[model samples]
Target: MEYICSVCTGAYILGATGLLDGKKATTHHLALKVLQEKYPEIQVISDNKVVHDGNIITSGGVSSGINMSLYLVEQILGKTAADRTAKTIEFVH
Candidate 1:
């Protein structure tokens, strides 16, 4: 999920609901600290543009959202399909 939004409230809500609990996730660099504090159960990983914890996938900023989508497409479809979609969106992954 893309956690870039107003303040860190949206991200905090999602994480607090256990969606991100016991999962490795990330958010916009600016919100990392808040994320960690709000969701202590979640392992707020940094140093990555994208972090996937099983069914729960978390992304940093808007650009990272694009990357995460490409990752999901590649997982669901084949690499060829993912490549095509990325190309259509002018994104490289």
Candidate 2:
């Protein structure tokens, strides 16, 4: 299963489930300290928009989520398809 962190706080859920153990992750700046303090087993990254460790992908915040969505479309489909979808939605990469 692919686990994506919507915000820093969500990392706790993933970490609690053991999916984020020994993996690099990040969260919203506001939650970084608390997340790291709570999940010491997980490596917390700072000043990052996104962090992908294995099948788990974590985004910093809402905008990062949108970027991740577009990136996933490109990865699962292709650049052409992603571009087409982006154009349709009027979202530039």
Best by lDDT, which number?
A: 2
What does candidate 2's lDDT look like per residue over 13-40, in tens digits?
8988988889999888888888889989
Cα lDDT tens digits for candidate 1, 21-64: 78788888899998898778989888887786676667787778
Clashes found in each candidate (C-alpha, N, C closer than 3 A): 0, 2
TM-score of each: 0.82, 0.81
Task: Please give the RMSD to the true structure for each candidate, in Å.
Answer: 4.3, 2.1
What does the lDDT come to for candidate 1?
0.74
Candidate 2, residue 22: the lDDT equals: 97
Which parts of model 2 are misplaced by more than 4 Å?
1-8
So what's the TM-score on candidate 2?
Answer: 0.81
